[model samples]
Target chain A: MATTRKSARTTPAAERPHPDATRRSQRSRQAIYAAALALVGEVGYPKTTIEGIAARAGVGKQTIYRWWSSKAEVLLEAFLDLGEQAVHAQGQEAPYAIPDTGDIAADLKAVLRATVDQLYDPRFEAPSRALAAEGLVNEQLGREFVAKLLEPSLQLHVDRLRAAQAAGQVRPEIDPRIALELFVSPLAQRWLQHTAPVSYAYTDTLVDYALHGLAPR
Target chain B: MATTRKSARTTPAAERPHPDATRRSQRSRQAIYAAALALVGEVGYPKTTIEGIAARAGVGKQTIYRWWSSKAEVLLEAFLDLGEQAVHAQGQEAPYAIPDTGDIAADLKAVLRATVDQLYDPRFEAPSRALAAEGLVNEQLGREFVAKLLEPSLQLHVDRLRAAQAAGQVRPEIDPRIALELFVSPLAQRWLQHTAPVSYAYTDTLVDYALHGLAPR
Candidate 1:
């Protein structure tokens, strides 16, 4: 029975399940994601366990173990799915890509304004802060969060800046990697530490200061 | 007896005891500071208690209570003293001001480089990360850390930038509050998130990119 169950779990798409089976699988995945996020937000990362997630999702422990290895793995993928859903809800084309509308400053400001909304969203804030707080003390988890979540988002900016360089909007000699941080890091600092409230106006000012220099033009 | 003990605890400096009593007081203070840092580093902020700190310091619980009302108060003053000790160890003037050599860019880079050293210091890293991790989850503590610890350090940069504005080294139109973040926030992000390695060269690049437009001259 165990052998048969393991085989069923790893079955390929080409082997084709019934329509009912596919629908059930999709529903289970969604339930698991929702349970993981809600549990983490409520109890924080340290207390959140696979058992709790399974219980909350009304799935067997083997069901989660068959899909993912650890709680961190589940949460990471859940956040990625959350970002995709947020983008889809916004009707954005190419959900993860930064926009390049010829004017680098204006484009960057628009995306940062969108980020302000996401950061302040009640659905996103609690779970994100819980995970972020864990990441601060857990080096292994912190590195994973940076690698899977943050670096990809930052790369979008890097790619946009590189394109700006090619179009003569940015200096050819400037390092796109470092240049992106001038605006990106300040907003990140505000969100992570709650040093100050973030706003469309504040991010707009960051882009202006970053592009035009803080000294005389 | 209770009144006598309380009076002894609150004795004014003019009515203080002899030299041996003063030396013993200093020793107890140092032990308490060391114990607070170690306990926070080991068990993290939430689990660390005033009782644990007193036990670890080999002092009576009342000794700690006599000096500080709570663990947060003890840790805050301990961290403040730690910063002062670091500055003194660096052989700089007391209250370690940011240098002003007329070149705003160079001065900012120099100070950030010193900060990079301090952030990576072994003695500072574990306890600081523990407190910071707690701050992310505890809103009240988070605000207190920002207002008491972070804002004071940031205000020094504001003062330096305002001086630069007066000297015509920086654009008068730029808000010194926001302008300082260009150099400061990147280093902060790198440390807090371990997003990247920070060094003198990296900070120097930030100052140059911040002061000169990323577009061609």
Candidate 2:
């Protein structure tokens, strides 16, 4: 449940850009993120390169190499930045958690509805699909991405499920890790496999099904 | 839902192989299926070509073209043939359905265990992973593959669930299509993403979680 797969480190502070260059570095960083995302979305992971990212970002190759060691690292941080921007766009703080409204079903439904929106969002679609496709075949990257990008969100659900269990809303015998998947994986399959259309209604139903028994009470 | 995605026909009898060449044609067909699956698994979908399949199968280019129109079509049929082989390997009939033993939960767990075996099988894994990765990015192929390959199996689940509903083992109001995913998609996500290990115990837990509400028994 806890992902320790994020890369070991980035550029050290002592070797970092001075305050005078901080503004310029920040601008360059954003450009690199945009460029990385666009390149990956356009040409896919195998074809995407640090050279392409640097050229598209209008920065020298060393500028990219100094901060991130590989294209994968750049894309990983780019996705993190995208998520931060999405949060900030909604007038939230840098570290946003899934709202725990005390009502387990309602909270889960709300979060899944937001996820449905993210899946449908054009800006998120191409890049996510590209990354997910790469992950399907690339085991190392897949595990790393799931650890860093996916599991954190999943961990939030686990936390919520644990909280629900504390309140006796959920059965304590159920494993929160797997129980959360009861709702999560269905929506994911629908999106990733195009098995069905996604909607708020669909996610709401998932929450309902996960909470109430599928069989007659 | 029934899939209308399969192509109209295989071949016209008049243009088919002559009686004297029937055995040779059968051999060539199996070779083509093997080559198609292996090539796609090795080089992936885009780089995999009809020429590659024919060459690998040791048949002429025209031999492939005479039957299938495109690489996708070849892969699709190859997958179907592979599935039939898996069924036969299990000592099952050509058109196998999930067993309904008057217990919905038991039947679901049984089918999911079989799915877990298929997911683990080397013959099924490589080609399935390759095709699924391609489908993630290729909309046309994704829809077609899901309609042709995945939906048929899902329909079997639907039919069984409907029977359960009639037997009052499932809630009448529950939509079987979505309800089926409660147990099905978790196993799928674990297999697809390697989020966790899969086992018969795990799938059995899913059935229990689904059939008996997560809130309480």
Candidate of highest DockQ: 2
Expressed as tens digits, the lDDT of each residue in A152-215 for candidate 1 is: 9999999999999998989998988888899999988888888888888999999999998988
Model 1 ranges off by over 4 Å: A1-15, B1-15
TM-score of each: 0.93, 0.92
TM-score of chain A of 1: 0.91
Runs off by more than 4 Å, candidate 2: A1-20, B1-18
CAPRI rating of model 2: medium
Model 2 iRMS? 0.8
**What is the lDDT, from 0 to 100, of the residue A111 in candidate 1?**
92
lDDT of 2 by residue, B80-116 (tens): 9988888888997646699889988889888888999
Error of 1 at B63 (Å): 0.7
- DockQ, Cα level, model 1: 0.75
TM-score, cand. 2 vs. native? 0.92
True contacts kept of 1: 0.79
